[model samples]
Target: MAIKPITGMLRRQAVLDISVALGLGTASGYAWWYGYHVPAVRHRDQFYQKIEEERAKAMGQQSS
Candidate 1:
């Protein structure tokens, strides 16, 4: 089989396709991180913070 030579138009088209793929990949990655990861991490931190606050209050009441 003969190898196909890369033409200028083909090169440009390839570039556009690659750029679009990279952009979409970046956007989806950001959406997943912000929508899912960030909220989960925030919820976890808030949960721990609430637990700490309750513990502190309980300790204060014991000391009083």
Candidate 2:
């Protein structure tokens, strides 16, 4: 026996899958950017400043 596929149902399912994939991809990208990337970028200068201060303090201690 051979099975036949329905055209409209297949098309509908394909469209739904594509739309879901696109939506999830966009949402994850947005989440990653805001959750990880943005915070790192925002704190970058502060991180550098703290490191510089620590290094200066170490240098002063070494020189003493």
Backbone N/Cα/C clashes per model: 0, 0
Runs in model 1 lying further than 4 Å from the true structure:
1-6
Poorest stretch of ten by lDDT in candidate 1? 5-14
Writing each residue's lDDT as its tens digit, candidate 1 over 1-64 gives 9999867998899999999999999999999999999999999999999999999999999999
Alpha carbon lDDT at 38, candidate 1: 99
- The TM-score obtained by model 2 is 0.63
Candidate that would win on lDDT: 1
TM-score per model over all chains: 0.78, 0.63
Judging by TM-score against the true structure, name the best candidate. 1
**Which pairs, if any, clash in model 1?**
none
lDDT (10s digit) by residue, model 2, range 1-64: 8799766998899999999999999999999999999999889978999999999999999999
Error of 2 at 21 (Å): 0.3
